[model samples]
Target: MTDDSAALWVNGSVARLQGMPDDERLLDTLRWRLGLKGTKEGCRTGDCGACTVLVDGKSTLSCLTLTREVEGGSVTTIDGASDDPELKRVSAAFTAAEALQCGYCTPGFVVALAGLLKERGRSAPVEELMDGLQGNLCRCTGYAAIARAVALAREDAP
Candidate 1:
């Protein structure tokens, strides 16, 4: 690490970025620099949840987050499901409920759900959990299975 470089904990590992720009977005860093393409870019603005990732165990819109702003924070992307227990549980529930179609929004939904469970606990009410995902929009599958997946994750999480 150099004086001009900063780092963040990504997927349970330290990711040191050299000569990073001040205005670089976390979404771009994760996708282009780190090659973690699982976090899709639905909208460059925060309106879409496709760029969601867990920063310090909280769901954040990476499109609106500056990479340098999250320096030293733990970032859990969907690609790191196996490295995070909550993410693993949520992902399993999503899979079992067959909540994905086209798959572009799956990562955001999973990460958002995992973050909600982490914030609200596994015992959080199903309605609250579902409501927390209001920012996440999916053009396919109609969210019935997604709702089921949320319940399953809440029930299955320990």
Candidate 2:
């Protein structure tokens, strides 16, 4: 690999990038370059968490993150959720709680919740979990089901 090239672990696999510009957003890299389309682009300004992903086990908004900034870091997206215990647990909770509506924001909510649970542990209170997810928004379901999913995710965190 050339010195200018960069590498990062995506979904537990090494992804080497070549000739990528320094300004390339991580969201674009994940969706277009790597074809991991699970991370959506809701707002490019980072106000929305639609592009949320886990970087080294912490929640990150890919739309606002530059690819070069995450070079050599481990990134986990909804595509990788099934392989991660925390992510899978939260995903299951969302499903069990019927939190999904239009579903565009479901992946962000799931990944963000998993990251928060990982950071704060399963013992973190429901209010704290909800606060951590403040950046994620959904126009459907009135957030009632989502709130239930958050509580359920906390209840079942491993």
Candidate 3:
């Protein structure tokens, strides 16, 4: 490892990174380097949203994002969202709706829903809601519970 270094704000805290490989993905940095494992790596490609995280409060695929791209930017993982009131509501909604089976994809769904709510407001239409969540895939829990969780979160949103 050379003197390559990059710094970014992660989960509201500044992360000073050094000696990172050029090909390292954001997911790898978050999980291995930062020890934030809530962001899962489902597919290495961008097909699966399991590695979703909020970059500057917008939903982004960590697997597809390179570590260097996050330099000077802000990242919010599921662990970070746990401190947010809005996301707390979403998490409660997920629980009430029983939206998770193995819980592998739950963090991605929560991050996506939080991004959607922030972008479209709490009164987003059903069509928009469906579109916003289309990127995520859950094999065991199915989509019904997830949709219900979104609805519940919307209703609970202030």
Q: What is the TM-score of each candidate against the true structure?
A: 0.95, 0.95, 0.93
- Alpha carbon deviation, residue 79, candidate 3 (Å): 1.0
lDDT of 3 by residue, 1-158 (tens): 43456888998899988888878899999999999999999987998799999898899999999878778899988988678766778888899999899999999999999889888988899679879999998968578998889888889442
Which residue pairs in candidate 1 collide?
none
| lDDT winner, 1 or 3 | 1
| lDDT per residue (tens digit) for residues 1-158 in model 2 | 23456999999999998888888999999999999999999978888799999999999999989899999999999999879999999999998999998999999999999999999999898999999999998977459999989888878442
Which parts of model 3 have CA positions greater than 4 angstroms off?
1-5
Q: For residues 10-49, could you state the per-residue lDDT of candidate 1 as single tens digits?
A: 9999999988888889999999989999999997888869
**lDDT of model 1, residue 51:** 93
- The parts of candidate 2 lying over 4 Å away from their true place are 1-4
**Which residue segments of model 1 deviate by more than 4 Å?**
1-3
